[model samples]
Target: MFYTTIFVIVPPFFLWRKKMKTEHLLEFVNVSMAFDDRQLFQNFNLTVDSNEVVGLTGQSGSGKSTLLRIAVDLVTPQSGEVYALDRPVKDWDPRELRRNVILVLQESQMFPNTVRDNLTWGLKIHGESIDDEALLKILEEVQLSSLDLDDDAFNLSGGEKQRIAIARAMMMNPKALLLDEPTAALDTESAIAVEEVLDELIKTHQIGILIVTHNVEQARRFTSRVVDIHAGSG
Candidate 1:
């Protein structure tokens, strides 16, 4: 008689816990936001470790993207505090803070220039220099190794543009990435490609990701922990 052995696979959370660093890359304490009479978040608190993927989900106006913006200091809460790298968001230099906690929006904008130009634009502004070999390595990570540097950014599809934007942010070696609907604009194929890249990034680089996605299925697949603004309030 032959016996069958079945293996049970562990969830991503267990693996993530093993790899996570002690310190949180970002944190929100008693956060509250309102637009005039409308209240978005009240007494909201969350923390993102240095090596974890957190998914944010909610309805259309539930402050998912707004939360990410708060991390990067793009939007200030009416009350409460946000911290990055253990320092208060308001205390850090805006340019320096953005370098460490970069935000990549859904509709990523690309300069009407060569792909290489767009990739290096941030570095140029920050006065950082990298060789072609280093540059090409990052391109390969984003699955754009085959594209010519001279290729026009405007010619690429929406997915390609998003990937380029992500690659640009990666060049800064951020501690945490704030993604607002990263794959929302992509087709199935493109979305899958980007997802694969994100998986590798988390596994290899141990970069923390706070992603705001409306697709619950995608959130389940991508994140170890999911936070719903509405649910959390109750």
Candidate 2:
């Protein structure tokens, strides 16, 4: 009887350890990156669970944006690994990975189309047409309630354009949002609007957010946790 109990308990314990070892929302151990001769980060490590917002801040040349790109698999690190959703980022299909972990950038580029079309572009590309109410709800979530449905996206202001870009990204309902300097070029009002929208999206959708910014004060307003990076020192 003693031997039987011992066999069962030990096997289960070992199996549980194995499963935990392979399970993580996102993880990077001893990650490093370089561009030409300049080192971006060395032995940098990060781990984030689902639905958590992570704020990253650093100096202009400290590679904060580059780190965001690396997290989403857009930029490969010279050495080290990136994992998303418990799998190596490189092992996942690019399209699938993108759908799962979407990146929102600072630059805004809109196709010459109606605001509706631009906002619903992601759904259309994914072989699904937008549900009118759903699209409108997303637009509203980003506080683009004033965006006329029939208006051309290209005619919008820079802040409007950025909001539209965010709407497009949200159309996929991704698990993680990796934002790279999203509010850098916007005015104070617009920047506040974007931050508010981001906060709402994360809370309502339960999506993890990682924002890379140079403004420490701005980061403090939105995220509960902040990671400050220094080049070559991780």
Candidate 3:
């Protein structure tokens, strides 16, 4: 008699982690970048690991935001390298790189569409889809559960917009998230609300987060490590 058998397989992460270095999710090695006629940073190095929150704090124009931009290939360094998930950022296509290492800037963009459309737009660009159940779950995770999917997304306050920006990044199932002063514009109450959502994200997920904040206290509050940018604030 012959016996029948089946094989089942499961992958832990979308990106291949076999060759990853000690759970490192994002890395900058000997990188150098500069603004017009003014050098911003040189020979800088940093890392963000899985299930970790790394903070960057410094005065304005200290190249903190520039580091976040370089991670996803938005701004390429004149020297050295930036890696995401063990692969050089230059090796990944721009859209694909941005998806894996999501960047949520201070003044996040809001489309004229509804909240549902704003949430799904990134996936649509990638030719992907998420059901209503999943969308609702992400909303709750970002502490915007009170928001209606069909509501005008442009009407949200600064804090709400920042959280939605994070939700938009979360929609991509990113391995790393880069935040440039995510709570800079919000009131104390608003900032705390956003931080609550971030605390939950850290508690429940294996992703890495790098936040740029002028407030060292805020950074210390949420991040596993806080890095102070020394580049002269231009």
- Which regions of candidate 1 deviate over 4 angstroms? 1-22
lDDT of 2 by residue, 2-69 (tens): 99999989998998888777665667767887899998778777776666777777777878878777
Which lDDT values do the candidates have, in the order given?
A: 0.84, 0.81, 0.82
lDDT of 3: 0.82
By lDDT, who's the top model here? 1
List model 1 lDDT by residue over 17-126, tens digit each: 66454457988888888888999878888888766888888889988888888888989999998899877999999999999999999989998699888888888889
Clashing residue pairs, backbone N/CA/C < 3 A, model 2:
none
- State the TM-score for model 2: 0.86
**TM-scores of all models?**
0.87, 0.86, 0.87
lDDT of 3 by residue, 143-223 (tens): 889999998999998888888888888898888889888888888788888888887886777788998888767876788
Shift in Å, residue 83, candidate 1: 0.7
The residue pairs found clashing in candidate 3 are none
Give candidate 1's whole-model lDDT: 0.84
Clash totals for all candidate models: 0, 0, 0
